[model samples]
Target: MSASQAPSQPVPPSWKDLGKAASDILGKDYPIHGSTLEVKTHTPSGVTFRVFGLHDNKSSAITGDLEASWFDRKKGISLTQAWSTANVLRNQIELQNHLAKGLKFELISTLVPEKQAKNALLATTYKAPGLHIRNFVDVFKGPLLTSDAVVGRDGLLLGAETAYDAREKKVARYNLALGFYAPDYAVALHALGNLTTYSASYYHRVNADVEASARATYDSKASSNVNLEVGTKTYLDNAAFVKAKVNNSGILALGYAQALRPGVKATFGLALDTLKLSSGSADASAHKIGASLTFEA
Candidate 1:
């Protein structure tokens, strides 16, 4: 006799399962994507060639200046593509070195990053317990002696990161963090809290450089939809610039990063950037701000 129906058992889903689902969902849309380069010249066909460069795994922020040059043997003038190629290489190099101490070295070439349709979060984890650092620059975890995976129980995330100036001196201060979410607590204890709930387990970082750090940031949802971060950072040694000399270094930062959709974001940031020397001989600073729209990965 044919069975009327096949046996089916309902499977139990645990916190781990839920966490995995969350991670998978979030990891698909990371904020850090590749950069763009634009240069203007006199000629329409002035563009000789373009090199889609990648991080040489040696620099950070700026590309390495290696193949940083393009030849314009015909017109004896460098074209737009040539200039762009230079910046790309330089930017790649800079990014690699800056993140050297961090674990973003692999960020240079990754099918995951190129796959714009899918958000990419590292699937690796710390075989042993470990800590990580976070930074505003690259969109990846730091040199994780321990890895930070997508999902976990108790909902605690631990990480840290740092930033450097053009002179290769560490300037910005970063602290590893722990994010905790007690879903049960939210449901049983509180009712007005069903948001993408997350709270810092802890945030701490100390800057040893000569410059003082003055910075603050607020990331909240209901009571405070404010995203305010400002701080000052100085250098320990006197750093020099082209046609300019300075004895001090400091940065006043302000930014707001918020969610635009379930897995998307809109970001805006501005900073007062400067390099000052102790001798009071040189001073330099610039006003900078940028906007970025991203997916939550």
Candidate 2:
């Protein structure tokens, strides 16, 4: 086929998602303390209900949210309402629609306990063959503006993001990232916090049942301050999986998750101070344990 008639490559994910592959594996389902219970239910009428509860030695609290959505499939318009009760009771209403073939628009407004409209944010996204762009503005507060763009071709990706303080008339923050994404492995290098901190992450799917990830961060402002962590996840079977991670600070964490039923799952986590363990002075207080239960329907 001629070059003009050939299919274009797919666009890369947004800048915020540049290192998601590694972050997701390293940070999910590893609570340090307390027991958490979560329940979710969905109705045929485009409504979803979620309830979450946390109980620990110190305190217990419960929170929940209800989300409803209306969509016009033919017109590519979606309207959503979400009410959440956590530390503070709040409600959010959002509308999204496609403005053109490769461009989309979104508007979101949040309401709090005593404020009818606490904040509003406007966002737009555009995606072309090998490029993606996103822009966001907080129209309610200081009118802060942010933009992100990513371009990818043949598995290589480059992205940048910046935020501007419109009210202060200055640039707030900026970040740059370079990454490579492939079917089985992904790697990303990021310069964040106005180049004060640098981070690198790598993720690899070794096989059908095993995945490994590593992340390291260095702070230019600190003296010899570098942190590194490596983690791995292995599926024992179709219904069970285990994860283990260790950091340079001599902390080790392990997690196990099992599917109890079709819609129910349970997870248990434990963390230990390896340095204290080596000294033979570790006590029960030096170790942390956590568990969680999830139900969905």
Candidate 3:
């Protein structure tokens, strides 16, 4: 009788192992898509600082320029939380009396007290109508631990809406952004509108007492092949507070982005973004800001 061979034990797929394997093959494609850094100094303080920049992709952009501050005085508990607000309204005025059509605006807020908000959005508004049969996939790694995979049957879409406050390039003190496109609004509404608090934080960016924030965006015909885009994004560590000493975030930002190509393809806007934090005061607050972008269905 022929000896029967023992069945080989199936190896359970480990996320980290799978990630490494994927990285070995795909080559870190999501986090390293091309991020720019800008210098925004508070002239009054004479403190020259730099902020990590964001990409120009619609469907996967959310919030921008959200930095955490430190509040010395605490009401009761020695809470170390802070917040800031900046109003941005960019219009195509004229450089050398020339007409430019890159009019834009955004408002993003963030803070991390209890920690618990973690997730990254990638790929949006990318496709080649002429080429056809395109595919896009995104994988994210952070505290909350969430994965974003966008499979585009036409081409690839990319986006980045990030505002980072970092004294150093590698480490950002406060990272935030808000992007609005043609596809993410509905998802945000569905996600946020159904929760008891509707405000959920995974890693460090959560909503504590008086925690509330929002984002919006807009985009026009900015691509020849249906306005394709590519960009990258990253988030900082989180320390949030959930239930009774459950350890969670102190602030949180919830929203989505989309894209709408006028008159050509079925005008499909995709959405993907981030979840961050924004502190209010040393105490008695958690989150703030309401933001959204873009103009179209």
Candidate 4:
């Protein structure tokens, strides 16, 4: 040994150092900070209420919404009303098990009231008796506008769901989606020809408390982008849970949730910017931190 090199001096923890460490681990992806809070309660008479709040760090704004829903078990119907900070009100009704035993069918309708325009969304879901296959149709009415505002036309979104139980406790699923103008539904004969997008996913149980899944999707229109995401969830002791996710773009995120009490919980999340590491730009590494609290009674 040329004289045992002096032990490297330990570096103190600093924001920059932390950023560099995260950059080294994550590679090129960036994260933006956001947070949410939720509270839910049920009255003795069976009425349920929920409130949600969200915060955006970049915008430094907090927005909230509230919803009250009640289910009539005897009638298999649910009614809900939700109001958001944006002055939008949504009234919804859901009917479950609307059909006899031959098939299981559910229908849901939502009406949104706004000063600019009134909108409605209707959806129907059908499931096989044994729950092996499922199908759905959703229709949106009103002035539906895209970013370009060129396709501000009402449309119907049709989809089908099918799953296969693979060997060794693995499962695979496929979802086919199609979108077309509501006026053209009759002319199209509800064809699957205009396949707008489709997604495939596979899930496996790593163990009783852990599961992993991967999903890939492709869009035929709207920029024609393909996305892939892989994630895992682990159930920890004491009503705690953790999740980790990585996207095809190399972004990584970790989330932890802890139950503070029987009806209260807290959650924390961290996302690392892996992309900056690949480009050797640790200074530009963008990491995010978010936290939320939830209560249910």
Off-target runs (Cα >4 Å) in candidate 3 are 1-18, 24-35, 38-50, 57-63, 66-297
lDDT per residue for candidate 2 within 27-52, as digits (tens), equals 88786677888887877765666777
Candidate 1: tens digits of C-alpha lDDT, residues 1-297: 345564432222222222232232222222222232222222244332232333321233445222232334443323121223332211221122232332332222222233342212222212222233222333343322222222223344333323444343434333333334342211111111222233211111234432111112233454454222222222323331011111123544343445545545554444444543345654433444444453322
Count of residue pairs whose backbone atoms collide, per candidate: 48, 0, 65, 9
Query: For each candidate, what is the lDDT?
Result: 0.30, 0.84, 0.23, 0.56
Q: Which has the better lDDT: candidate 1, or candidate 3?
A: 1
Better of 1 and 4 by lDDT: 4
> Sort by TM-score, best first: what order?
2, 4, 1, 3
C-alpha TM-scores of all predictions: 0.22, 0.89, 0.16, 0.62
Q: Which stretch of 10 consecutive residues in model 4 shows the poorest summed lDDT? A: 143-152
Whole-model alpha-carbon lDDT for candidate 3: 0.23
TM-score: the better of candidates 1 and 2: 2
TM-score of 2: 0.89
**For every candidate, C-alpha RMSD to the true structure in Å:** 20.0, 2.5, 24.6, 19.3
